[model samples]
Target: MKNIYILSIGKVYRKSNNLYFIDKDKNKRVIPIEGINAIYIMNKVSLTSNAIQMILNKGVPVHFFKEDSKIGTFYYLGSLLPKQKKPSGKVHIEQVKAYINVEKRSEIALEIVDAIRYNMIKVIEKYREVYDYTKTLRNLDVRKEFEQKMTDWKDATNVIRGIESNIWVIFYEALDKILKTYKLERRTRRPPKNEANTILSFSNALLYATVLNEIYKTHLDPTVGFLHEPYEKGRFSLVLDLAEPFKPIISCRILIWLINQGIVKPEYFKKDLMGVMLNENGKRVVIKEFESRIRETIKIKGKGRKSMLIFIRKQAYNLEKALVEDTKFKAFRLVY
Candidate 1:
């Protein structure tokens, strides 16, 4: 039910009637402006200040990305940090304790790491024959087996960082898969060669953006993070927090599906002066794949009536409620 108007082409303007108007050929059409949560301006779509103001009044932010897919800026008129309420000392101590609790709560965080790592490993294996990087990592797995290890990870922090290390290896391996899966005599950037990689990255970006958006409304400070550092340009700590729960379950699943279905291959990306880049065609292929992924849903474990999207929104709200009510905060733990 969340509506996102993706403006990849053309321009839009706001009318006096409080409607957004767009031009097609020589005729003007009214774009459905209601129910829109955000507008993504891809390829730097132009718009008037009046249009921007109208959108801000409606509580919809505008996301601008450069032509090369770099994050340009986010235009949300309100201050995300304005008049912030501080958590009481008791509440703050409780949050840290909840995070460190040696119970089901601690296991909840560990589960997220394991799920994400497992899915990343699957992606590498799925495309093992295609990419050299996959082959290298796969070979390393064989060699590392001699080290011998028990599967159980007792410490939650150790479990989380350990899984992340393995996931990074798989991420590079997946990138390699895209490079070798396709066959072309000369690499060209006219269109992206690896549709799978393009789509996966796009999907991750969207996921991260959503996390950051939700964090702004919560009592949890977005800047303070554990795994991802709070940096100057991209202080995306909150996104990292949210992605911890979803990496293996959603991102990894989409990667594996693309490889198995032959939806994307090495031919989808090309090497250029910039190293590797997706062509326009590849971008379209991946965007479509990402759309399909967003639509894919998992049944929420509890509250049988609600879907995953509903579950995610509720989880964000719950964090805020917990903080305001001076209760412990629990992060979402993905079971599958």
Candidate 2:
């Protein structure tokens, strides 16, 4: 199953038992509902009630993104599987219980932070082979020293977050060195200031949505989280938590690859008062590459070679086991 991205102005509707999309230019495309994992609408598109119902019944999610927005809005039907139907409630209860228990929450948060740190270091190390990032790696060593003092901190969560933030700062420093055209002085969001920040913002947003889709396949609650505080409104904090480690492994790597390979050019972006953002052409190229990368297989211990999407779903299952079964929850790590 693959995700179908609608990057054109179109109307999607159900015809007979099949789904079809007709663009404003009268171009028609058939969408195979059974083979679809999700639908991402990044441009102006309309979905008929019948089409929406069809996708829901097939257990497919629709992710909507506004132009130049960081995150996508999600719409999907709740789980329909008989086994998940009853266990989902129990799993959610266990999830909330783990959150309310301070020790458990702290443990989970620490694991997440460790995963993030490990991945960030791996990314820097990978690029160091081709680029002169000696100063950047030395700065990372200093950050590691601060991370060692984390145990003595009173607020473990806040301290762990600080460590994560500092790692990102150092990682961006490394990126600045590797990128020939773009200078990533600092990480920025809510309208990323430069091309590097724009790519990072867009790529991370896609990762968040991908993680959320995986979470929907499991019994875990998306609103309740470990590393990030759970909120009743806005942000799915749990998605934010799970997406942290993968940001370096997936999004950051993709950004460097796209820019360095000349797959994404300066002409692909536009700068306005709001900030720098990918143009329509840039979005198409990035989304196509992103989808291809996720589907590519990698060798993972015990699991052998598996696609990134499977690993993401496995991570969700790992969290569920940790919460409900009192098993160890290992965050996904990139193999160097």
Candidate 3:
């Protein structure tokens, strides 16, 4: 993924033939948009119409992130304009038909939830030796939830979310033992009240955005989802659904690794009227670490070993297979 990251307050415009990044200090940096997959605007960055046109002409998407959370995406006109956009092919059509049929939707939703549950259990079990999680592991009812079934999209979604909530509760509890500095009483969103919550939310948002980027490269529609309903507006519900199994297995591990490596300190966070958040330096550190984490290689069945980015794209392809060929979509499970 050839991604250009912009983190500072700057003005971006199209010069003679390249994109120029001019900082508040009037210092300019040239970024050739050639071979670039996406441009990530992480902070307050101004863009010119010509620059926008240049990006569209290159068929590159621009993703805007609010603070540390991803707000929305600006896909190229060719991607958004129905008349210009190509069909998603037969498999994607079948996937949409399944969405129209509630029974199939419920089945896929259950499979997604099942994958999420299995991964959560695997993550917790792997960390059991590192932390005394006997009580937490005993309280987790993975078997009962695995055997459970749902009737409709709403029911399946509710159960899936509820199970996910419980998993995080226990997962955070176990982490609190190792990461004593950043205490997570419970999972918090919007204004993350604590350092742990702030790190988790930011990195999780990155995970969501990465999934969306992969979906853009595939034939799958980012809006049409199973466990999550496709919102009429900008919400990428499919990314949210697919990102579930990955957040615990990837983002959580990266956060813990950062803490253990002393790369992240408590002073990196700040609290204001908006709530607790990573400072500028903190954002740089976390973003750097997150980027490195995605590039790290992992072993997979049949594919041998590959970087997490490729793994993500392959997972998206697996979903396409599941939708098109009526095959089971096996979510990634991190092996310790």
Candidate 4:
């Protein structure tokens, strides 16, 4: 199954069980609902009640994004199928229990941090093989710095988060040195400061939604998180947690590839009161590449090969197993 992205102004409606999208220009396109895994609306698109009901009944999630906002709204019907009918309350209970237990929560938080650190190193290594960024990486001493910070880590999630943030600072510094066209001096959002920051914000939003979609298919509660606190209402803290490792592997890598290959250029971005952001065309380009990257297959040792989307789902399942069955949870690691 694939995702359907509506990037232009359109009206979506259902006719005789078929989903169709008609752009403002009256150009109609047939959307195969059965083949759709999700729907992403990146622009102003009106949806008929019938169309919304059909997708909901079909168990398809619709993610909506505003041009100015990175994190948007997610719409879905909750637990429609028999398999999803009774999501194991046992899993939810265990997840909350683990969260309340300081030692267990700390262990999981460290695991997530380790996964993020491991992938950051992998990303640097991959770039070094193709580009002469070794000097920048060495100067940053990412691994050594992270190790030193870890030495002072306590059973506090806030400290773990602090260490994670510091590592990203080093990673971004190396990234700025490697990039020829863009500079990400520091990570800024809610109006990303520059082109690199703009793309990073957009990509991370997409990844958050993708991980949340996968979480819905499992018994894991998206509300409670190990690394991040579940303090904000309506915020999927667990999705934020799972999205950490993937940010380096998926969002950051895609940003690097797009900039270096010249697939995304200055013309793709524009500045407004909302700060620098991808134009309509820019959004389409980024969405196309983001979808392609997630669908791309990679080989795993015992698992043979799997798409990035499958890996995401497996991560959720692994978390469920760890919480409910008391099994060891193995976070997804990028394999060269």
Best by lDDT: 4
Q: Give lDDT per model, in order.
A: 0.51, 0.77, 0.71, 0.78
In model 2, state the lDDT of residue 333: 79
Q: State the lDDT of candidate 1 residue by residue for 37-137, as single tens digits.
A: 44555553566777766766666655565445232112222221223354445544544544444443334444444444444554454454545644544
Can you rank all candidates by TM-score, best first?
A: 2, 4, 3, 1
Error of 3 at 154 (Å): 7.5
Candidate 4 lDDT over 12-118, as tens digits, reads 99999789999999999999989887787866788898998898888887877665343312232232222366657988999999988876887787788778877
| Model 2 agreement with the true structure over 1-336: per-residue lDDT tens digits | 788888899999999988999999999999988888778787778879999789878878787766634321223223322123345788999999988876778778877777776777677775645345544444444335445766754566677677667767667777777776776678777778888888877778778878988888888999999889896457888999999888887888888888888777878888877678888887777787788778989997677898988888888899998998876678887763
Best by TM-score: 2
**How many Å off is the CA of 237 in candidate 4?**
1.1
Estimate the overall C-alpha local distance difference test score of candidate 4. Answer: 0.78
Query: In candidate 3, how many clashes are counted?
Result: 0
2 against 4, candidate with superior lDDT: 4
Clashes of each: 13, 0, 0, 0
Tell how far residue 186 is off in model 4, in angstroms. 1.4
TM-score, model 1 to reference: 0.63
Question: Candidate 2 regions off by >4 Å?
Answer: 68-87, 129-154
